[model samples]
Target chain A: MSMHIMSAYDEELKYLTRRISEMGGLAEQMVAESVRALVNSDLALAQKVISDDTVLDDAERQIGEKAIVTIAKRQPVAADLREIMGSIRIASDLERVGDLGKNTAKRVIAVAGSGIPRKLARGLEHLAELALVQLKEVLDVYASRSPEKANSIRERDEEIDAIYTSLFRELLTYMMEDPRNITPCTHLLFCAKNIERIGDHATNIAETIYYMATGAQPEGERPKDDNTSTLGSVND
Target chain B: MNIMSEAAVEKALDQKMNTVPYKMIGKDVSVYYGEKRALFDVNLNIRENTVTALIGPSGCGKSTFLRTLNRMNDTIENCRVTGKITLDTDDIYDPTIDVVELRARVGMVFQKPNPFPKSIYDNVSYGPRIHGLARTKADFDEIVETSLQKAGLWNEVKDRLQEPGTGLSGGQQQRLCIARAVAVSPEVILMDEPCSALDPIATAKVEELIHELRTNFTIVIVTHSMQQAARVSQRTAMFHLGNLVEENDTDKMFTNPDDQRTQDYIMGRFG
Candidate 1:
């Protein structure tokens, strides 16, 4: 974050980074709160998570507009250009993270008061814990401008996806075991998917941070372990 | 400090092998003014019908390297340029070469819109008339029309061709200067921040003109604006502290320059 000879330009860029960091903070909070609500069946807290998403949405819009203005005014090039572009991209990903958290919260209301299986709830909580960790670490990478940390965060996504695949299989087994468990297990399955998607959005942020730090897109293919979509029927 | 062999550095820079014939070539070029060296061993190739941009911080020798192309530096007392500069295989600095003919073949536009005090028509016609490029009145008229049209200022000043060239707005005057340079049918055009004195809209128009003019003539532009270099040039050469730091494709140079000094300068971290 070297200052431009024009201090005003430096201030504008700093403001842009600050707005993105604020959005990241809010997205991470929503993800954590939504999962807490789901695990505890706190319907009011879930509703709170849903309503708080607008803050992230507003932050994203502001960042986008600010980035556009900064570009128009400063006409940044090279690393400065990358920094502004990275802010816009990271803001969008954080907004998606907020949406995913909101969707998870909505599912909490859908399955409220149903005597959920303790094991299924715990499985979802485990997935949320991992996703929340990824989200937090990726945010740290961006804040610190640490490409190495971003790379590690990107690599850890596969572990989250693997856990999600296992969760998907366990939920499918529960649904097949008892006809009564079908409704709750299906909702829990979606919750697990939402958490998995949160992991993905975190990985997207990691990739963006890497680009911002190095001025080049991360080389090679991203490690992917999400196999839930490819799973066939449990009868097989 | 990281040390690399010259060949290794050159390979890492990924200099593209130019296939087209060069309009101008400078080999082992150096410049000095009374013991103060301004450039050192700079080698560059100006491709035919392509826009090559020279960019660097102030006093980084970009303009000096540009002046060497057409030997503009020869005008300054004790400003000595040592090296070989060839235009279509003819030595530009040869003692026998006529500097006037060399300048007619290689025209230049400066930072400010310096139109002669004469009428617009006279400004565009001056070069052809002096160079004996037009034999008839019809030829003079035709050259004026075509140069103005190619400079994208034909319609704006056609009715006002009788008006003084300095009477036009800043942008129009700049365009008029460009038309004047084009009037002689120069093989190459050297623009040194031709749009610096213009407004944004005017700058855009001149930039568009530069893009169009490249089809008929080779162009070498020196600009302080990096975005302009990116937008207008196919090849970019970065100069730093009297050294040719890197020369490569414009996209590569801007996005991921191989030289750390180039990266630092583009990133605004260099002093």
Candidate 2:
């Protein structure tokens, strides 16, 4: 039947999209500032990032409720339904990423006064920066539906792996020189790797967005530089 | 390949298994019976090997959408449908399309127990005979047996193939109609409230029949019962006031919907 096609329904869909975008924005900011806190060694900023996570978590719950309502009410199909399912999955990944950022911030609090070498700290900061760039860029790709940007994000993940390798090696050097540095350097290593994993999670979100928009999984693996050896344990 | 590569290949295969055939595709479809519009710009792909349930309140277009699948609405004068509806990838409404051939590929069982006024075997074989779907008497007998078996009626009706179809109870009659629809060897079957006329026991039988039919034919069913929709369909499409309110995997749509309207309807706040 040719009904009037109510504006109320249109407004509701727009509201759902807006709410999800709002949640996504909050999650992105949490990851960025959490990394910034690590780099600047600002204990207060790290604490603030941890405290603000409940807001993002709560946003996930809100968006989840809205998504359920949309599915019940709209009966969307094809591209529309794809986008909604993608958004639900993305919300889940975003929430998990939020928790990971909180964990990183808590690690910052733990390793605050360990007097780690300046060079090791620099390596950690570099890793954080690479991952943060990947997160922001992948999210931008999702918002714009730019498969080119998504492809680039997939490509950019290699830089994060490189930074993690560099961080791993530097931390190993610290442990080799001073047996006392083992505990703190190990914690720092995990912190850097956690940030790298967050980048990977963001890449997963990018892949879903690409699928939702284009109806295909992105092609090809990102180039991995073979020259880089594994960061070997000194025992080996 | 290494175990990791083998695992990835297996994962891809598992994904491929998740995709079944698409039985029906409606593109920009709008249906109107004279001045009354029953559906508006409805676009959907009914998946194969799955039961798809259309649910809505009275006058909400669920039945209209279901009838459109088999072009059952074509019988009503002044009923115009704009846009394409394809069954098994062939546009069913194309001018060159033979209505009989189309009906043979896509058969429908109406809301009530509408068994033909003929012997059980005759009712089941009517379509196949008219369409010449069977090549011989033995072929017709085999078709009837398979259809009756598929409809879960062979055990009761096999000895009474000569008995009149209308002599059966309402539930048995509905199953007979289902058997008749299946007799033509259709690629897809459309059911309009196939259980509406039956008792609870009969409804359960027909529902079980629908579940079994999914293995061979894509089935689209319309029901007023939300619980039935949830029970039967892999995917559920809900309609409200001639618009597709929401469609999704049945579980997700019922437990979690992306629209408030869908939520309200499923929760029984309003249609």
Q: What TM-score do all the candidates reach, one by one?
A: 0.91, 0.58
Question: Model 1 misses residue B243 by how many Å?
Answer: 2.1
Per-model clash counts, in order, read 0, 27
Report model 2's chain A TM-score.
0.86
Give fnat of each prediction, in order: 0.42, 0.00
Per-residue error for A46 in candidate 2, Å, reads 1.9
Q: Write the per-residue lDDT of candidate 2 for residues A40-93, one digit (tens) a residue.
A: 677998998898889878887887787788878866544456667877888888
| lDDT agreement with native, every candidate | 0.89, 0.79
Top model number, lDDT? 1
Please report, as a residue range, the 10-residue window in candidate 1 chain B with the lowest summed lDDT.
B10-19
> What C-alpha lDDT, on a 0 to 100 scale, does residue B105 get in candidate 1?
94
Quote the positional error of residue B102 for candidate 2 in Å: 14
* For model 2 chain A, the run of ten residues with the poorest summed lDDT: A1-10
Model 2, docking class: incorrect
Query: Candidate 1 has what TM-score?
Result: 0.91
Candidate 1 C-alpha error for residue B199, in Å:
2.9
- What docking grade does candidate 1 earn? acceptable
Q: How many angstroms is residue A81 displaced in model 1 relative to the true structure, after the best TM-score fit?
A: 1.3
- Over all chains combined, what TM-score does candidate 2 have? 0.58
